[model samples]
Target: MKQDIILKRIEEKLKVLKKARPFPPYLVKKLREQFSLEMNYNSNAIEGNTLTLRETMLVLQQGITIKGKSLKDHLEAKNQAKAIEYLYDIVDSKKDIPISEMLIRNMHSLVVQNIDGVEAGSYRAHDVRITGSKHTPCGAFEVPQKMHELISWHKKNKDNLDIITLATEFKHRFVHIHPFGDGNGRVSRLVLNILLMKQGYPIVVILKNEREKYYRALQKADNGNMEDLVFFIAQAVERSLDLYIRAIESSTKENSLVSLSKIAPQTKYSAEYLGLLVRTGKVAGVKDGRNWKTSLDAIEQYEMNLIRKKK
Candidate 1:
């Protein structure tokens, strides 16, 4: 699919979600804790941290270290949680914090503060090569200049590009520079999300299961083709949008609603078809456990709109 079309669909869902923003404080708290655990686990896991999701939760929440797990692994989980908290602080701040070299460095420092204090917030002094890849990062001496250029580019083009494009391009360029000797991947992901959250979009989580595919997308971006990466990132954003939308819908009190299966007999569409519509935000509905529940009136309204479009 074309990037513009996918982005347009994402924007449509975002509109619905934005209207429901400042989600109930309890829901907001729940989402924050949930995404923090998932994000920390996945981000660190992709970097070869040995902690599983459950183990990460244990380390972060209970301070219960796993037997035989490396201290670095525990620290990675803890530091990432701190980094996530910092990201949210920036997002919630009264003052707007534009993306900058300092912001990037601060985030990197948070990621590796305990593991490598000397180089935590500092750029590398030696050239580095990415393992298992053909891309060579800028020389150590050129790191500062390249990072300056990246920030300038963001300021110049942020308004012209859509949020997904802007964030994905920034991630690609940042990783391409590989400014830091270590923790570049973690910092890149944090910066990508900072750009997104600043624009009011939900944070995108790159799952550990997608490790190979995510690397391939970055490689493709290095080759000057960023469509795959943009789509990959967009899908994650879409999932976040779906979660928020479903939560908002379920919270509202309404009568005369029924499951898609029950409404199927009253409309021309099958339950499967209506379920697809609900999932894609084409119809108004709430997901009730395993089933999509919606009002018959919503289905009728959607049918009427389709008829009008056809005419």
Candidate 2:
């Protein structure tokens, strides 16, 4: 799909999400905790952290050490949970925390605190090369200066660019700079969500299963082709929005309980196709014995996502 069209659909969904906000405090907390576990697990997993989602949750929630995982693996989960909490604290502060060098450094520090304190919050002191990529990071001496430039560019263009584009650009450039010796990927993802949260959007979790595509998008951004990265981020945002919409709709409406056959007539898709989607887990739903039961909103979101993908 074209970047502009993808972004327009994301913006439309974001508007719907904004109107659905001020979800009950309890629901909000529950969602945050759930996302924290998923984000921490996926983000760390992308960086070679070996903790499974259940293992990460066990470490974070129950403080139970998995028998075979490395200390660094456990620490990565704990540190990322802390970093996510820090992000939320900033979001809930009602204080304007502009994207700055300090904020970036602090987040990086939280990410690497237990693993590498010496360089946790500081920029690298030597040139670094990213593995499996042709792009070279700026020299250590240039990291500070380039970071300042990045912050300035964000401040200047934030109002001019749409949120998805702005967040994608920031992630692309930040990773391109490769300021820190470690935790760059994790920190970049956190910062991306921070930018989205600042704009009243839900956090986008880039799954570990998407590692290759995620890396490819970043590499494309490095090559001055940002369309791929933008589209990738848009899809993630759309997924989160769909989750929010489904959750909210399910809570408020009694009409959420419906069979695939019933929603088929309301959508352009055939019942067989809708049933196929349910069986394949493309649509969010529960099974009532042999039949697939799902919410109307889920069908709507599924159709909208399909339309966006085709465009």
Candidate 3:
């Protein structure tokens, strides 16, 4: 099939997906902020310098530094959030442009940041491989040709799929190709959220507890069965929606549930500065915990503390 035709088919399928999943106002607000936070977190994690889930949370809440003991530990612990944050930035841009070279570079840059022996912000010209689950394939799988084909194929047929499913398939294919020497899982998940956030969905964080089930779903997809993959992605979307809904509901009672876009203007600082603060462990309130459960008051206090320290 022609690449354009295949892409169009995928896009049409995405339209159906949109119809299948719709978001209300509160959910939209919650998703906007949460996904942004998550993308930043994931991007940092992938580069071999990350905090634990708890430490990341504290970074968001109290702005306390919870450094990793070493490079491997940091990457293993924080890569997921770092990669997702990378995705959020791409998909959440206000430029109204299609995903382009700039975005890919940005994602790659984040994926390789602070990692040892990895060229941060560059694609691997070297060979890559995907190690399957124990129950799945045992042999080490090479991915150079596969990744090149996928990218070329995506460009050829991008129009066929809406930005959302394009992101989803990209995520799937990224992991399938395992293009990087390490951190493929983190990058792939981040790429997925980039697409989802672009489509106006919240960032979906699969908890450590559910990691096995998540792997199993992907394993099924690897075996030429997409039912589980489709189901799992759909469920992730649904959970993202549910997370935002809960956040809105919980915040509404306290009259603190303001939309992120709206808050962006009223604050004394730019989002970029806040993001840096977030990275350095000096601010709080983000979209995580399958919902925006992080406390806004805590965020406020953390920011205030930063202000005092800066003086």
Candidate 4:
């Protein structure tokens, strides 16, 4: 029932976003660049990559290497950028592109190319356990069949499930399968974005700062409870949509999206309260670098919602 309401909100915001399309080319490029960097840095960081966000920007944008970071770290950043670019090409060029094992392998290959050349894209040959997690992935010999099953399951459910539900469930299933020797989480996120982008959703970044929450949701998902995971992902998808709406709608007298500190003074919510609200998805906003940003309009909507609930 809760998922139904959230999904409705997502679809509604998505409708508003779509009508604003064809968005300006410059806006598309700028937003793409922001999401690409955030996705690359945050996804890699969650998997224990050591590059800081700013360092990642240097590696990705300036072709400059960080002095203390490992060569593998630099490559992971570079490779992820390339992989996401490949993803965008396929997503934009093809309509309803079929998801296949080949596509998954290609994405993994692009992700871990220089870091693990031999098994860059291949399923592991031996069973493995996730470090610091209670779940044990399928046995080594089972990976091939498991992945095939995953693809088949996707085929069966693609049209039946909501896209966000499909994407989050796929994230859990793919990581739980642990098909590749490495880079499963990264690949899962890429696959998630492909599923979303095809459906006209903006690129979703699972923030590295939210790593604990993300893993907790996944843990809940492992036990067959999908609500936490879906809600987490729904928040992320909504954040991306907020960015699109803010960009497209910024030109008018409409409320402008600014950092929480900037907009808090204009509303009843304190900076601290607004931060908590955005972080928890009680209100719609965005994470801009290290700072949280929102608008008076978002708070107004939240207030209206609160009043309606009280009545």
Cα deviation in Å at residue 22, candidate 2? 1.3
Clashing pairs in 2: none
Q: What lDDT score goes with residue 141 in model 1?
A: 99
lDDT, each prediction: 0.86, 0.85, 0.55, 0.86
Candidate 4 versus the native: TM-score? Answer: 0.80
- Model 1 lDDT tens row, 222-308: 999999999999988888878877866675435767888888898888999988887765677765556667777667767788899
Report backbone clashes per prediction. Answer: 0, 0, 23, 0
Candidate 3 lDDT by residue in tens digits, 1-311: 22344444444544544543433333344465566455445444433344554566555547555554554554443443455544655565777645543455566666567768876655555765445363421223434456567768778867796554566667766676665556666666666765566666667654444556777877776776655565556656665565555654544443564434445566775656555544443544344323332235545877787699999
Model 2 lDDT tens row, 1-311 = 57888778778887887775545343465578888888999999998888899999999999999998999898888899899999998877788988889999999999999684448889999888898788999889998899999999998999998888999999889999999988899999999999998888887899999999988988888889988999999989888888887776664354576887887788888889877776665666655667766667767776788899999
The C-alpha stretches of model 1 lying farther than 4 A from their native spots are 254-311
Candidate 4 stretches with Cα past 4 Å from truth are: 251-311
Question: Each model's TM-score, in the order given?
Answer: 0.80, 0.80, 0.58, 0.80
Q: Candidate 4, overall lDDT?
A: 0.86
Better of 3 and 4 by lDDT: 4
lDDT of 4 by residue, 1-311 (tens): 56788889999999998876665343566689988999999999999999999999988889997998899999999999999999899889856678889999999999999784448888998788887689999899998999999999999999999999998998899999999888898999999998898999999999999989998999999999999999999999999999889877762222466888878888877899988887776666655567766767667877898999999
